[model samples]
Target: MSSNRVTPTEAWQATASRAADCALFFDFDGVLSPITDDPEASQPVPEVLEALDALSRLVRRVAIVSARPVDFLRARFGTLSEVDLFGLYGLERSHGKGETVTEPAALPWVPVVEEVASEARTALGDKAYVEFKRLSVALHWRKTPEHAAEIESWAHAEAERRGLKVQLGRKVIELKPPVDRDKGFVISEAVLSVGCAWYFGDDVSDIKAFDALRARTAVEPGFLGVCVAVASSDETGQEVSDAADFTIESPVAVGTFLADAVKILQANAAS
Candidate 1:
């Protein structure tokens, strides 16, 4: 809602008008689906699928960069086509044909993550909750605010012991493999391979992608890229919005924005 920031609707319109040579990136959890207590339970808004289908036809490339595992995301959106999917915060990339590219060094981290989850469950006891992601383990302190400090300490200690990295967002802390790759790195690589790019995200983790876009624009004129945040009354959402070029009210708004972008691109193409 800053003076210089655009609304999701307006940003989508601008993106659609210049769809050619554009690469679109999306964050799955909060941007495509409403965040839930159980991350695995998150489901994309119905319209998002339709809009992605349309947008794929308009843009040069569309990719999803998420912290979820590639296999999980593929299973979730198995029917969609022409949209590239990157999971584990871009540590893994997969296409529709089931071909997957992953950092070989990070492959061993899966079992490490599982071990951490077990450790968290044992360490936290009944005070905190653990969500086991294939590539990472998230410790949720939403239901145990009194144990936030303890949870953070445990997460840090476990990550250090495993020689991994920790990412803090909202009321959750995640342990990811120690790699120099992230959504930003993925976006930058994608742009180099493709061209202009745009990104939509809804959490602090997505800030990396936003920063990447800003950095790219500074070096290249008319980059035709923007970062959008899906705003919510939560710390993670606020952090993401602060770094974004535009903010949408909710997941529903995000779907509407995507749908509008597809319409604009289609209309422009027809004209």
Candidate 2:
């Protein structure tokens, strides 16, 4: 772990004291579940969601912020009253798992994004299908890792041509509207009501959330803001780890951390 990050013991110590007032934020893929080549195939670890259900009963708030769409998120998470799923970063939000609110500012970009997805599918064929997202398009090359560079380059050029933004992730490249919204915005908005905010994530987009936590902690010196990186075997995890205040080994470790957190929170509540 880097000097900036606390060990698990230290993280527990720091969080335990403030658990009652803390808000927990997590990224979906790679954090709650392992990444899948088919985004549609990704599902939360059963233990993970069950742990979240347990923790949510004790915590002030629990949120899952991710690049996945709200519909997919709602389907997988399924009416978990304790969790808020913010999809496509902050462009859409599902509160109490009831209804998702899509930002109106993002509405105008839908047609353009759809057009980009269509073009990408026609050009890349089955290799990069499922390019149509109302707010973004993703070209997954997880199965074809050898073509990563090729796909990335092409995606970048296409994004530039179409005035869109591209995000790099594990075995995937996403082209989204060039909106100001991101995981950072979601965290920044979330931290205002909570005393201590902890965010766990595992990708380039999560870096924005880490930076937000770091920034909010600076101004609100009393805020216990923690950034946890749920890493994979790849280098992408290293980048996320470098920016994190703590790092967990893998999604399984995230479950362990969450379980421990639940115990600590419950213990503190009892005491």
Candidate maximizing lDDT:
2
lDDT of 1 by residue, 37-135 (tens): 766688889998888877888888878888888888887777877888998888888885478888888888889888888988898998887888767
Tens-digit lDDT string for candidate 2 (1-271): 2335567667656777777788899999889988766778888887788789888888788888999888888888775877888999888998875877989888898998899888877877656545566999889887777777777888999999988988877778888888888899999988988888888888888999988888888888898887888875575556778888767877877887788777877777788
User: After superposing candidate 2, which stretches have Cα over 4 Å from the reference?
Assistant: 1-6
User: Which residue pairs collide, candidate 2?
Assistant: none
lDDT to native, each model = 0.80, 0.81
RMSD of each: 2.2, 2.0
lDDT accuracy of residue 229 in candidate 1: 81
Which candidate number has the best TM-score? 2
Worst 10 residues of 1 by lDDT: 1-10
